[model samples]
Target: MARTVRDANPDSRTARARLEPRGKPYFRNLEPGLHLGYRKAAKGAGKWVARHCTGEQAYEVETLATADDFSDPDGLAILSFRQAQERARERMVQRAHAAAGKTSPLTVRDALETYLDFLDANRKSGLDARHRAGAFIYPPLGEIEKLTTAKLDKWLTGLAKAPPRIRSKAGAEQRYRVIADDHELFRQQ
Candidate 1:
């Protein structure tokens, strides 16, 4: 068990900062940003305490009634270390994104909804956006994660190459290999 001591600055570039655990009551498998030890409660016997912090200033902790290392508040044992690490990592990512004025782990639905929600009936281009979203966006790339540009491009290209919705129509659907919607071609002019 190694114990380190240091203070963290909240507004610092936390992802690039070191994750050395600073201070106290260290126990088995201790690592930076994770500390588990025993503490005496005011009214009862001593209990185990788990502390985890990202490179940011705030520390989040969990208390255990007994000496059990992996028990949750429900008294059943759970994998605490891995879960805490993941949580810390996610928090760091989210914080960085927030600081940069961007959203993190953007779901496919969220990005789509943003444009759809922002479409104003007053603007001339707003209806075009809504049209693009409905007629071109949803059918192919339905509920995928919007985390990466590569993913969006790949999805769009794949959708463009996929078989058409309506196999054949009254009009010249034969010229187009990947029509977004074949029904659009058949509309009575």
Candidate 2:
């Protein structure tokens, strides 16, 4: 078997202590721009947060596995420093690709979709209304690299003139909703 260099074990209390504010949060350099962080969220149940440098910025991502989960009932370590170190190394590599890009490309449609999902989850009854309110940002200025004042003006014009997507009446009698696209919305912001 191939021997490996080990970082602090995730299951060790000593390792967890080292991640606190007083102690050094980062340990053994698995590679440049990539390292482990002991993230304590609530009391002794926090997980590891991996900090990776990418696109001229550092991004911290949670590994989602708690140190307490691996420890024995009495809080004694379940694995040796060497064994836990090996496991942490493996997990770090697996998470690199997903968390590497801090400045990834994002479009207008993506933002709208995310917002729609949020509305559906948080404000269940308002999801449809929210979708209608946002449908105006399509057409000539459908997508852009972040919104500028000029793009927003164009969006306002489009909203006022764009025909409604749905005008049919259903069992409940669909009524027209006034999308909050008034110019005052911009002036106040």
Candidate 3:
């Protein structure tokens, strides 16, 4: 006599077939994107189904429904999904770090603000007038964070060679002296 398999639940119209490799069966009305597989442990254990995505790389991700059923096939699929997710997360973090590394060390706007603040602080302290003027012309010579010493020296060199603004003879002499004094101080340090 031939064996006939009837529906497990007579009240339900769904027809299930046992998937091979493991005998778990899937319902005939299974939703799209579902890949049915079987569990290894129990004969009556439910089917394992995973969702599929299309891209340059294809991988199976077991549906959340199968998480509680830790049979061999489901376990493998879940592990693969977790590994993919972790790799993607790591790549994103690395990309963020690389992007940050490419930005300039000191922004011009920030450097300008720091230089102005240095001038104001020195003026209030009754520092030498020549030093104050030199600090004004070479804004970066004073204490300005993030501007490297080499960059400040370059700015000062440009100022020394550039023509001075015409003013009273005494004022011009004072400006030249300030520049000369600053040059000496920078060399000594």
Query: What stretches of model 2 exceed 4 Å from their correct place?
Result: 1-97, 100-104, 130-134, 161-189
Quantify all predictions' global Cα lDDT against the true fold: 0.51, 0.55, 0.42
Per-model TM-score, in order, reads 0.35, 0.33, 0.20
Residue 8, candidate 3: how far off, in angstroms? 55
- Candidate number with the higher lDDT (2 or 3): 2
lDDT of 3 by residue, 1-189 (tens): 999985332111121123233444332222243333323334443433333433455734443223223333343333233332343344344544555562434455545556657866766643454454454543444444456778878887887776554344644553432334577776874
> Which is the winner by TM-score between candidate 1 and candidate 2?
1
Q: Model 2 TM-score?
A: 0.33
How big is the RMSD of model 1? 12.1
Residues 1-189 of candidate 2 have per-residue lDDT tens digits of: 999965655446656665544333444444676666555444555554455555467555545344553454331333343444555566566655346542445667666666777878888756675546444454455477587889888778866776455565455544554546678974664
lDDT of 1 by residue, 39-83 (tens): 423432334456656467776666533422323433333223344
Which sequence of candidate numbers ranks them by lDDT, best first?
Answer: 2, 1, 3
Candidate 2 clash pair list? none
Top lDDT model = 2
